[model samples]
Target: MAPAIMLAADAPKLSSANTGFMLICSALVMLMTPGLAFFYGGMVRVKSTLNMLMMSFISLGIVTILWVLYGFSMAFGTDHGSIVGWTSDFVGFGGIGKEDLWPGYTIPVFVFAVFQLMFAIITPALISGALADRVKFSAWSLFLILWVTVVYFPVAHWVWGTGGWAFDLGVIDFAGGTAVHINAGAAALGVILVIGKRVGFKRDPMRPHSLPLVMLGAGLLWFGWFGFNAGSWLGNDDGVGPLMFVNTQIATAAAMLAWLVYEKIRHGAFTTLGAASGAVAGLVAITPSGGAVSPLGAIAVGVIAGVLCAMAVGLKYKFGFDDSLDVVGVHMVGGIAGSLLIGFFASGKGQSDVEGLFYGGGLDQFWKQCAGVFAVLGYSLVASAVLAFLLDKTIGMRVPEDEEVSGIDQAQHAETAYDFSGTGGGLVGSAAPALAAESKKVDA
Candidate 1:
């Protein structure tokens, strides 16, 4: 009979175990945003810390609603020849419930929906750091909504959704090398180009306000990553989950060591920032190849990512692109390193069907991996540039010069994060110096 009616029969079944595990995974990923908030918040000048936190916090609420609506359909619907998804699956989710079927699992379609929803939420937030302290809060919120619909949905369709070109081509992104990291990394580049650099990009020291917050953020990210990488298996299979878990740990630990060593050699000090950044670099590298590579391979990926990213971060000064926070160096470089390394490590010579040049499997799989990396890099950069241009034209990008000097937190949001624990105010709490000055300016 009808195509919709017929497709219903192809739907899979839902189970409690799958549902529980996935929900937990979703929560773990959700924690990443706040972790990201702290990570980014510490990097900005103190004048804008709260604003950075708000940018990330808002994504949790805004994207969640959007995902439940057309966002899901656009990303996951029946694919239309590698470009985008058709809306035939639109509102088809209404019928999905606790007992409904998901393609890969016995979990409810809703659970799958929520799991993917967590991804959608974090991707846009990842780009926020690049635009920090310049754009209006309202404009940023609007940009995130539009960017998710335009840039994120189509990319997600191409990478993760059924019949996606990447999937069909056998590109193995265990979690989000292409879908999350590359996609967001490219978007960060686009926004940075349109917005220009933060005030005093090269001149200002702009040290992180709190190293403790950065460490906390790194810890949370490392914790949540277990879910991000392992849960990609979509279920508690006999060995895949444990394997991914071990790889995640090994890679992160190795990357941390690699980064610390690099900092010691190059900078003459093993700063806390280096360790935290190295751990993240390792995590990004492991994400793509975790499922495909063995434990030893994972360590190799981590070490390479650490050293490569450490080197890459210094390129911003030489090339002078101003990534603001090194999104390109760590995520983009690390993603490529991990994805390509798997070609050698996973080729059946060791623990997988694909072998690398080292294992004597030759260059075939390596080339395939290279092809995937270039494809993602090229597509993402071009698509992201176009989207940024469109938004820049329509809504205008970046704030006025005056606002940049005054601090976005006070100028844009009309608020400040700290009042020195109320010690800065006196005599009936004369509204705190910063707050009182702003009130007087408003009245005048």
Candidate 2:
């Protein structure tokens, strides 16, 4: 009996259940990129649909390779002064072994690495929506290479890596409120500022090419978000993962309802666009707060996010910076709302001991969340802007004016999202705007 007990004590650190769960979660998170592609693709003019989809799909290929090369090292390797991380061990996934476990978790280091890679993949893809129709595919691709290397890897280190400044300072980003949503949102704003509007700012009717595609994309995002949020807990060893799961569903539902309500009251009808964007807002808000708040708190966060994001979407017309797909309104504003609300909605009983303002924890946690949120927001905005500027000056970020005005999908990818060869004009379906405008010149 004593020999058997001693042998049992020397078991592998890996947990098969947790490992399997994380693998599933990684796959789910990976699905968000395609979901995002569809969402953005549907939101743009038909001429830009394939281009938009390609923008996101390209990242899956690009980031996966980068993550395997050095992204993981920069993000999760040993910290260097709390700003970035470094370690030769993870560079290329060479030195690591299958038996290696992520410290403080039961899953293999490989599982955690791949899981985090999914996040690294999707964050930059989120920015593509803002630059739709106007950017050169090659330029955007190069920008991703640099942006992820410079902006994402470092911020990820700060927010989630061991000994990270935000992690050490007790920021309450349950998943990626700061690192992913806000980071991408701010970056989107920066790029749009550099690239300017898509030919006809307010004069053109840039309605979505397909709402059904948008809804389908939104549904996929909402479904995959369960893994994105809940899987961040790393395992179901406790109730935090399950808690996060329930809160995710609750918050998303509330946000969707709130958006529809606001739309009906203000616009006289509940829009499908509004519902889709609202659900995403809730997903964004709950991303950083799910593990820290109660179900009721999730509802409040969702409602606030839906209303705020719904209102914020109109700011592009007000401010005159063309965000092609409202990425800034929905992601940046939604991310900020969710991250900041952690200070108010944190229940102090879920994941951490810190209490939010309503939970008797006062403004302390709120302040911490602000620091984390604004720090990431500020860094991403400035850094992303600088990257875009560099790209603009070097290879020229915007497509040629004729290509954009006629059809970006055809010009850039050499193929259209739909076939119009049977038409008298040949490809006239994709080039409807050009045929209408004829020789008219846009006021660029």
**lDDT values for all models:** 0.81, 0.93
TM-score of 2: 0.93
Q: Cα-based RMSD of the predictions, in order?
A: 4.8, 6.4
Count the clashes in each prediction: 9, 0
Per-residue lDDT of model 2, residues 1-444, tens digit only = 999898768754789999999999999999999999999899999999999999999999999999989999999999999999988999999989988989878899999999999999999999999998899999999999999999999999999999899999999899999999999999999989888998987998999989999999999999999999999999998799999999999999999999999999989999999999999999999999999999999999999999999999999999999998989999999999999998998898899888999989899999999999999999999999999999999899999999999989778876677765664433434566675576466532
lDDT of 2 at 246: 99
Best by TM-score: 2
Residue 360 lDDT in candidate 2: 94
- Residue-level lDDT of model 1, residues 1-444, one tens digit each, is 789887888665566786799899989988998999999888878777888999999999999888877888888888888867765455546645556567667777777788888889888888887777787787788888878887788878877888888777767778888778877777777667666777788898878888888899989999999988888778885577778889999999999999999999988999999999999999999988888777888888899999999999888788766786778888888888888887777745322466677677787877777777777677767766776677678876677878788777777666676676665312222334667788899999
The runs of at least 3 residues in candidate 2 whose Cα sits more than 4 Å from the true structure, single-residue gaps closed, are 1-12, 421-444
